[model samples]
Target: MSADDSSATARDSLDGGAATLTTRRLRYLGAALATLVALLHLLDPNHGLLELFALLYANPRVLVFDPRPAAFVVSATALLVGVSLSRNAPNRRPYYVAGIVVALTYVVGYLAWHLTGHGGFLPGREPLLHGVAPVANVVRHLTSDPWAAASMASELGLIATLVALLRRE
Candidate 1:
């Protein structure tokens, strides 16, 4: 074979190798992200059970009612989606997209209340709920509450994974 043919073969092999590596990396990332989100919901100290229903959606006195069960459900679904993607299912792309959507929905929905004048979800932390100043709120959460810090970190992770999914071949 000519020298040019050998070089082309080498380039083709390298391209294939890179694609395989990227696929594996994305799958593992999706799984890990899903697991973290699930853990956060299940182990949340602030929004557990009664705290979620504390306001009782029916009560007119309440401006914000966080249903903890819903959070659990969403988290669990994300976990399942992650597991599916990790297995490299034929429909992995759809699952990844769904997971991103779920994460975005949860984050936006939770922050919406604070933006609409509910103040922070937790008492005495009104300043932390900087809906108008999202960047500041993230900084404060990282410095103040462990749960919020984890949440912020997870959001970053989810965003990263979403970008990867979008760019994947």
Candidate 2:
């Protein structure tokens, strides 16, 4: 092949490779952001659950009265993002696995807490009568006490996973 032709082919190949690498990096970044958000939720320290509840209230469409569904959505999204980004990255499987595990655990725990009536992570009393908004009333009664323990566990797990991802070679 002529030198010019060979050079052009090489440039095109280089450009394609660079584009692929950039896409992969962006995906990884998205995964990292999702993981960070989860970690923030786990680490938040609020004694009354008021702050947490307010935060949830802010996004009523997502959190509503029942947080399990919302949490599930967040966790599921995180898992998908983590998995997609880590597909070809080194030591990424473990991070992705950890993230998925944590997300699932959070959802399961939320559901269990609601079923048991042991009180939720947030604090408030369930309205006497179930009105049009059942989830809101349920969420109101969720005392922060339950969250203290659960949050501690979640915080530890998320921190460990975050560290692993950061240190992955």
Candidate 3:
């Protein structure tokens, strides 16, 4: 091939590679943002915006004989597995499952809070409903207290793993 033709081909290839890298970076950023928001519920557990909304809307009461400690252990284990899976491949299923586990643990914590009538023990509060309706009241009380730090760390780990798995030359 002529030198000019070869040079042009190389430039086009380089441009294509760069574009692909940019797209992957953007996707990773999006995933990280999502994971960050979810994890925030665990880190602050009380004041985070998303957590507050969930607490006000759901009004989940703590179940009698709550099993949060056990749930935490299980969720943590799942998080580790999720991190491993993420490293191997962009396994959406495991990531989603881990997210659900984290969410459920928070639910258990909220239920415990309701049964105990102890706001301090949990993350957020049930908003006051001024004669709105029993249903509204119930809805307002649903809440959970997933640990923000652990959740955030797990999410970050997953993001890192995903990025590594998706990396290309």
Q: Per-prediction TM-score, please? A: 0.64, 0.34, 0.33
Give lDDT for model 1: 0.61
State the lDDT at 9 in candidate 1. Answer: 53
Per-residue C-alpha lDDT of model 3 across residues 18-68, encoded as one tens digit per residue = 745664565465356444534444334344443444544666353222334
In candidate 3, position 37 carries an lDDT of: 38
lDDT of 1 by residue, 73-134 (tens): 55655666566654745445566677777777657755654454444554543544445476
- Model 3: per-residue Cα lDDT at residue 81: 55
Better of 1 and 3 by lDDT: 1
Top-scoring candidate (TM-score): 1
Supply the global lDDT for candidate 2.
Answer: 0.51
Error of 1 at 125 (Å): 16
Instruction: Report the C-alpha displacement of residue 144, candidate 3, in angstroms.
Output: 15
Candidate 2 lDDT over residue span 87-165, tens digit each: 7654454655566466557545644554445333445525332342445544654443555445445544555554554
lDDT-based ranking: 1, 2, 3
Candidate 1: regions farther than 4 A off: 1-16, 49-64, 85-88, 119-142
